[model samples]
Target: MKNTIFIALILLAGILTSCGSVKYFGIETFTPAEITFPETVETVVIVNNAVPQPKKPGYKYTIMGVEQDTTHMVADSALYDACKALGEAIADQPFFKDVRLYNDAVRQDEFFFQDTKLTPDQVETICDESGAEAIISLDRLLFNMEKDVFPFGEVMAGTIKVQATAVLRAYMPGRNNSMATIYLTDSLFWSEGASNLRTLDSYLPKPEVALRETAAYLTSGAYRNFVPHWEQAQRWYYTNSGTRWKQASAFAAKEKWEEALTIWQSIYEAQTNKKSKAEAAANIAVGYEMVGKFNEALDWAKKSLALFKEQTSDEKDSNVALLTLYEQVITSRIQANNKLNMQFGKE
Candidate 1:
């Protein structure tokens, strides 16, 4: 009996120790609320105008070929492939909804020979013809096959470095005639190198798949970088009326922690309603937890609990659901604090 009891206690201690280990300490946390764009504001409509052909065009695409810098033998097949890939990439963007590719062989060949240069007049004509809100003109300055070292060590690696610049211009015909241009002077070098068992074709995949994957990557990266900016944008929309507070709640639903935090913080600081202020304080703690700031979370949780306690009239006012949630917060904090203490060998 004595031996069994001792073994049980040891096992319990082991269990506690295992529970205290923070394996994914900062990895996974609560997502902030969802963000819904205001329904009243209309989404901007955009379109892609066709590429203008040069006056003396031969091939459908003027520069549809791979040009060897050393030899100067242009490969027709390579150039066509590249142009097709670029057209697919541009077509995939949400901003370019309505797109029309021009089919003038003479003009296209001429433009290609001129290093894909398009005059402002040509761009305007294309925009007017296509009835497109925006025009994206593509030009391939240099498309060359080259050898490159893979970031991950690999033998016999090569790349197709597509060095081209594109210009995107937004043109409004009648309304103020505002013109906005963006220069896409970036190199998209795709490595032919693959893992030990994979080939270059495997790595490059189809243009559609590759372009979609790239779009997803860009969109995710942009959102991650723009979290703070989006939060600030939300603040401008927040007002004293319950509407802004409700908007903040909607953002919280979408797991937009930063925006929800900002709005909740504002409400906590500025709201006159005691209940709303307390709720905001509690939500701020939740936001901190989502961001992996456990210490700040605990502090805010304590503040919320104190406010809740002050607001409660008696045991009658403290309903079961509210009490349970409050207890969960306190219990979770205690466990977290205890685990932190144990990790540091605190007394």
Candidate 2:
């Protein structure tokens, strides 16, 4: 009886092992799913007419003091430092590429100390000689200093305001001309605490930041305005009727269905006469046919034909093109409907 019990246990263990093996072999496994990155799109800067010059090494500038006085001598260092700082700040901008700031070499001479007025032509000539695109001409009217205390009595502060104007003229080497002239009048405000006073230094970084931002804004605006083919299509269409009609015909010939349709829609909206509206509608229908929108095309074509038939006078010559377009739309729509019926096994 013990042998018989042992035999039954052995058979049960073998069956369980086979079942485990079968289950292990039956299950399927796979590697984790893979992911893909999007394609990189290149940024295109369109430059037509005169190509913008490659941003070169830093530009050199001559900073000249346009005024002279006893008080001006006392404030000379501060004024010079301020102009140099402003030049550095502008050059640091991304658009500037590179720049160098320098004090005017001809100092306290006839041109520098006298009541000299530098005209635009004179400034341009200076720019040409210096190999610089811009110049910083300083004329200081007033530099005043004042003192105040903090509310909590933590520190005393001294403030200085420098009133002046800066002119930026960009040169177009390719065109052999200077483009737009920019003028910025700024009141430079500076403040210093007791510690800053001890250091003999105090100027707000805010003013410099604001100045750089303003320059960047002006430069971008100028570049955009200078671009030749950047005007809107709608504006072009409104200004030149012949050009607009030619564009409409060209778009239709190229099978640019949507563009052609848009041009015709504009014409229809602008037309006051029934004949012009009918003609526009007929052309619009032909555009729709090119886009495979047969029903819409057929509708517009029928409307155009009805208008042509209802005209009081025989203006057949005026509508010859429109009539031809209408017939083409009707024929195409019929063929398309027949094709659709056959596709669905209805005919």
Candidate 3:
């Protein structure tokens, strides 16, 4: 009975070893923007064209049996912050020759708060005065807030939520139509619990501050639409009981990708097992990708996938799944690089 049990244990270990395992590593890849701008729009001016909100009506709330009145409305500072933050983010891009902020409010009489577009004359004037090639206007900004107070077990819990919506339009000096119109909305929330309602209220962010933060956050990400950005992504590699494979992974861990590629190439040439050869090809593809040889990287990735299909009987092999994803990623990178080159004014 002891000998039989030992034989079963040996078989289990062999099966586990043959299954293999995978290790993950991180890579930062350049991704294309949501929208691309024309080469003519090198300089941009951000303008505050929004009309500020009037005073809000007063409302009463009960805090621990005491009544209090409060009024909240959108402040002028929030609009300014939205414009300023967007301008700063655009300026960070090396493609833009200049970035200017027209801090003064341009529209003051929109009492009905209509969705008004900037006239061609206004766009030309702003571009000429700011020495910018394009005009980016904060057409309108709207804000609303809600507050709630409730009993949570024993203590009183208070929550404050604010939502801000912004309308932006882009124009070129000679164009009759706007280049782009974008609408963005963002929300902020704060919650706290205290023995009494008044303390919880004090702990929450003020309405004006919340509005400013939400607006700023909304505009901060808008620059990416006009420029390529870097995004961090993950990739997987095969690992097993081979000393040479372990050595190659060590070199890759230190980011010595050239040295790692040399070892992986040697392993791929000498490897007799189809699975081992496929793993080596996958690692080699990643190494070529790290070195900016995307065309070669894509070729090697295809080779790895074909080999994996031949050796993998289960169709759901982890190596096959990863190779499929890696192949797709390389293909996308190739396409995005073409767009990025155009955005950078390279042929």
Candidate 4:
């Protein structure tokens, strides 16, 4: 079975009506590219196109033109480290058979960080070497930093702003089609003060330190884009009507969800007045939704609407509009649940 999901679901979580207590759900954050590989595409190779710029013997470095001990070039393997992390993450997915994390070529002539697309020859070579069905290439992984140092009366202050962008592309064996690319970007800012020449010169983080920090921040959450993700979501439930309703609301607030549902069901079944029954039915529907029983919730929502019309048999009830709106909300929630369940729930 195939499932479809949209990134908009996360944005809609904040939308709510203040009729009752609240509940929670889990939803996917971003939409992934269309994955249309053949059934035999069970293996993938996550390769780093980035060339290793290992530090040379006794390489000198400087900060603000004042020789400092910031050798970001020595930490240049951070790209490879991030690639290792991505490979590990994919390995845990169980959807693939084998994965090769790296290629040991000491490429010294190419600007791998800026190359977004590999030549057809490069792609074929990588696949041939790894014997994988597809390849995920790190198109570019580079960071630039801005350093500003100014002097105060007896003290100096400095600010460092760093920005990093990582571009990734997936290549597979198939007839020609649009390949999927994942782009991630992040920016960081920090400042410090110094009182003397020594401190002033080293007021901010060293280049390697800053680069490592930025890489950690960038790669911390970047791998999620390549796989399915579940993020927390907030939702509201109606809980205001009478004593039993208030008690049920309190139970739900305490996370005694089953107790709350039982009380609401009692109120719904025992009430003889159409208005009271309609209100209770709406509460019960919300209860079902809290437990992820969206189909049942939808059915109870329809029942609430039927009772609401009966309550307004004389066309005098002012709550008719509110009940109609509540029914619409239930309908929309059902539709959202259908989509969310398909994406995150078991098939």
Q: Which candidate is the best by lDDT?
A: 3
Q: How would you encode candidate 1's per-residue C-alpha lDDT over 1-347 as one tens digit per residue?
A: 32343344344334433554101111222221112112221222223232332222211211114432332223333333333444444444332334444433213343343433345565556556656544333333223223233434654344544333334333343434334444443434565665542464456533333333332332222221101111110111112347767777677567787898988888799877666666677667767766667677667766765676677756433221233343354345456455444323453
TM-score of each: 0.33, 0.27, 0.83, 0.63
lDDT at 71, model 1: 20
Worst 10 residues of 4 by lDDT: 1-10
TM-score of 3: 0.83
Q: Over the stretch 172-195, how does candidate 3's per-residue lDDT look in tens digits?
A: 887788888889888877889998
Candidate 3 displacement at residue 257 in angstroms: 1.1
Count of clashing pairs, candidate 2: 2
- What is the per-residue lDDT of model 2 for residues 98-163, given as tens digits with 9 covering 90 to 100? 344443532233222232233556455555665555443332212222222232255545444434
Candidate 4 regions exceeding 4 Å error are 1-43, 50-75, 88-100, 105-114, 119-121, 152-154, 175-178, 200-203, 241-243, 250-259, 266-286, 297-347
Cα error of candidate 2 at position 31, Å: 51
Tens digits of per-residue lDDT, candidate 4, 243-347, equal 887898788777676798899899888889776787678767767877777688778878877887875575434344444554555565565554444444333
Ten residues in sequence with the least summed lDDT for candidate 3: 1-10
Provide the overall lDDT of each model, using Cα atoms, as 2-decimal numbers: 0.42, 0.41, 0.77, 0.62
In every candidate, how many clashes are there? 19, 2, 0, 2
RMSD of each: 18.9, 29.4, 8.7, 7.5
